[model samples]
Target: MEPEWIQAMQEELQQFKLNNVWELVKRPDPRKHNIIGTKWIYCNKQDEHGQVVRNKARLVAQGYTQVERIDFDETFAPVARIEAIRILPDIMHSVCMCARFQAAPKESHHLVVKRILRYLAYTPTLGLWYPKGSEFDLVGFSNANYAGDKVDRKSRSGTCHFLGRSLVCWSSKKQNCVSLSTAESE
Candidate 1:
């Protein structure tokens, strides 16, 4: 490899080491374990004038080759949906439930309302907590309780957005239209 590329790779490895990104493991049997493959990517980071300022190197997994069930149950990607500004509730599922019954609250709804009030009374200072030096990465999650509402037969969808480890935004709402299948609800 060229000296510049080698230097970039070295820098990348140094950063990983400092961060304690992974640990060395003994080689597993080929028959029992599906070892993940990795690749090295190199690029030149540029300034506003399009002048190369620094060499960048990245070590990445070749995830595409892995099978579904045998390799993993679920895979996560760091992505944010620009269109969904207000999304899932890490909290306030009860509050959302109360809102649904504004027009006609039942005895059960009244009990839930009282319970919510009691919670508020006990934990007056409770609120969204954010720590110092939190990461800037945006993470979002969404799931639905299919046909959960007995009255309307509508699925309740909830979503939560986070900036690093801190909760940023969330929402819990009943679907506008009824969906027949679980996949359709999602």
Candidate 2:
């Protein structure tokens, strides 16, 4: 890489506050634990208007290298469904409801935040793009294919609300009731 390009990339990484995308990790003690292998990834950052703004670097661990207890005790994480996200705003519509709600539990919140940080580390340059000259109209679409979930044999549907060609909101979920026929499901 050119010296100027490297310097520019370093500056951009610093601006994003992502200074630790790569670092050498001393090999873990053989008796003490398992250590995950890591890999480096690179990409270009794009602005909301779809212009390439900067080159990005990321370091990601090979999660499969982890061993139980030695590397990690638990690897499970919870993620909210789109319906849950959609309902949250509706549920909190009342001012009193917002006031009565308690903050998220700290430990869980910390774990969630840590996972997000790790994700950012692995995909530093990933972002949305809304280029100029696009249409600006409101449009929506909803669709589903029955028995989408192999575990439950349930039908699932999703809806996408768009502002012109830019997608603003979308959701996917299992239907509340089972339908005997495809027409009924539709």
True-structure Cα RMSD, model 2: 20.2
Least accurate stretch of 10 residues (summed lDDT) in model 1? 78-87
Clashing pairs in 1: 87-171, 88-159, 88-160, 88-171
* Candidate 1: tens digits of C-alpha lDDT, residues 1-49: 7888899888878877876768999989989998888899888888899
Candidate 2: where is the Cα deviation over 4 Å?
1-133, 176-186
Q: What is the C-alpha RMSD of each candidate to the true structure, in Å?
A: 19.2, 20.2
Indicate which candidate wins on TM-score: 1
What Cα-based lDDT does every candidate model obtain? 0.71, 0.56
> Alpha-carbon error at 45 in model 2, in Å?
32
lDDT of 1 at 39: 94
Model 2, span 5-75: residue lDDT tens? 57655654464355343465678896799766766456666789999786665444577654443222443
